[model samples]
Target: MNKKKYQIFISSTYKDLITARNKAMETILGLYQFPIGMEMFSADDSEQWEVIKQTINLSDYYIILIGHRYGSLTQEGISYTEKEYDYAKECKIPILTFIQDRNVPTTTDEREQDPSMSIKLNNFIDKVSATKMCDFWKKPEELPGKIAIALVKAFTANPQIGWTRVKGEKLQAVSSELAETISENRKLREKIEELEKLLVTQKPVLSVSLNSNDPIELTVPTLPSPSKYPQLLRRDHIPAHLTPYITDYDITSYNNSLPSKEEFEEYNKNTRYYHLKKASIDFDISIKNDGKLKAKDIFVTIELPDFVEVQDKFDSYKNVLPKNPIPKSLLEKAKEKYIKDNNIKPKTSFGVTGGLVALGSIIKPYSLEFSSTYDDIIPHLTKSQSINSWSSVKDKTITINVKNLIHTRQKTFDDFVLLPLKAGSGFINISIICEEYDEAENYTFPINVSK
Candidate 1:
């Protein structure tokens, strides 16, 4: 009985995955299959590429190991390893891919340092992951076992015209058959190129996705302290109703608890009152144009909750009265004390009435009201500042990714001043509109606000 041996083309970033490549070769040999790669090809020679393509064409199956390094690129700006994979695909060779697990950090030598190259590699992986059945490997030792299993499955599911030994008289016939197969593969490549050209004229189809799992949440700001506050002030100690309106002076006057100025300041610093600190959320969006036509002027809008408000200095403060009403006699005595302390004339027509009104206003509790507007709710964001450039491209599909789009500082709805935060939480709708499409696609989700 004669055993068949298959030729497997192994492709990857050379230097970075050298050990991985060796393990793959050993696994292939263990299974009695021939492993071929760019090891013998000269680095600078142009003819080596043609040889590489010929080798890929002759191989029965294709296997690629994608790592951090993008490897060297050709004149077309595509990496040589990727080009080989494309050629194998064009030839209809059975392909298996083992990608380095991105979640696991690798050694510096095994990773790509350049940010641009890293983006390219990631894009390439996305393309491969989308198109074929691929496995992820974190270490070189893990690759050989995984690759052996994948190859076994691939062979069982899809068998190819593998190599078998021939006698002296059959050698000439084998050579002729090899030449015929090469000619057929060349014609197939030409046909694939023609189909690709036809596909270029199709209409633009855009695909957009928000990568985040949870909704965008806002962080509450700690209140300002007047330098002297209780060392351990629990949320319960600060009366919920009186909490928002508590001022530095209230600490000393309330219940005759005379806390020093330093304690108040410390308390103020640690409290969560109407501090101008604004809260923001980040968005990670990806847009893809799968058609031949380009997607122009893509715009994305994130809508904040209606309760999230922006306040300005000129905005009127809400009048919050005390929980308990003061007696008339006590009010009159307080008014007299205020006039005497400030040395204001008590005989004017507006007299104590104006002073009483001012006194009443001062005694009333006050806190910031978080609000939002149609315009301020959706802050002006730029594509360059918010979204990232395209990371991957395969056929007509191109992927554009945005790592971070921060919406932290927002102007108050009434005050129109920049504040570190605004407090409100509920369902918010985020929309992405593009000139390429007519209607705006909206993403509505719930956000829970917490400190």
Candidate 2:
């Protein structure tokens, strides 16, 4: 296989950082890639800007170098360097920015002398730095190493369609093989037509079993318990010890501290803990080839009734939580309640000169540990040689493509299907279609579901 070479476009001010641009180009060339720049084109020419955009469009990556002085401005008052950067971004090209360190020493000629130009340079620097990660370069000697590393990282992270060389003889060889294949296919079709005329009707030998039997027993999944979710519980459950100290003020405060009904309902609906707490069961489906001849291109589709739902074993709640389980707002509210109940006066210290305040001892708020227990069941669905792929659910039907099954071979998909059924009774219909038989094999299983 031929290795792909990426074309990187270098954008920078010509007068101030010409040496830096050249170094960047050499770095890309050293990596066995192509480097594109505007050294050949006139910077002030209007026609050249269009060509520059076209070149940038063709580039796989973009590298921009920023120094003390902004490059020559276009008719829109934006620098040519900034214009190229903007165009590259509009084209969706991966860009690497290198801005010169402000603390670095430079000659007067290298820095922008005009106040207005200096402001524009600062604004441009701020724009690039605020948007993306930029490397700071104090010297032109640092360009090659920084450019090489950033380019390598970009190449790995955001790969693009790069250039590859192809030989003309390869195309000709492929054409010859295609012609030979066509001729062989024509002869095989004639033989198949003659064999079809003498063949008799045959029945499919593939058999499907749910849990190694016809009818599958399904049950409604149990809903999550309210006790497991303390957030949804009533907040009026006060401790017996605090009853003597409880006042009407405290009762009113506790009542107002409860989360809004809407917020509570939303949290209950969205939290992964609540969703995963519901218990689910997985059932296995086994397919066997009972014929002497092999079965090819086998497809098994199971049509489920409205009372039952089929889910993948891997399906579960995918919500990502923060490192800290407790919200800061809740913690703050708890701290305020603790301070109010203890009657602790928070003291503030003023400095001698009245310019600053002294730090006070930190208040360690009372801690309450919260935890919940629920069953998290994940079925083991192992890969089988007879199974190819499972199509997405459509119209309550799941289509599973089975690999070529040899004679008398049986493959079991362990815990491959989950039937979360409603409280009702129904029949699941299964159809198996293969190339070895003239008709599709059909089977039906009665299911009784209950809570």
Task: Report the Cα lDDT for residue 357, model 1.
Answer: 43
Reference-based TM-score, model 1: 0.38
For candidate 1, the lDDT comes to 0.62
lDDT tens digits, residues 1-451, model 1? 2287889999887888889999999999988889988777865678988899889889988999988888877888888888888888899998898888788877788778889888888888988897556888888999888988998888878888988888787998899999999999999999999987776555355544443344455566665433323243333455343344444454445435435666555445434333433332333444555555655565544444554433322321221211212113323444556556666554433335443444443442333233333235435422233333323323322233333222221111111222334466676455655554568776666765665
Which segments of candidate 1 are over 4 A away from where they belong? 168-451
lDDT, model 1, position 61: 89
Candidate 2 residue-wise lDDT, 252-343, digit = tens: 55556665666655565544342332434555677798875677888888888887666655543222321222233332344455556776
Reference-based lDDT, each prediction = 0.62, 0.71
TM-score of each: 0.38, 0.38
What lDDT does candidate 2 reach at residue 59? 96
User: Candidate 2 — worst ten consecutive residues by lDDT sum?
Assistant: 366-375
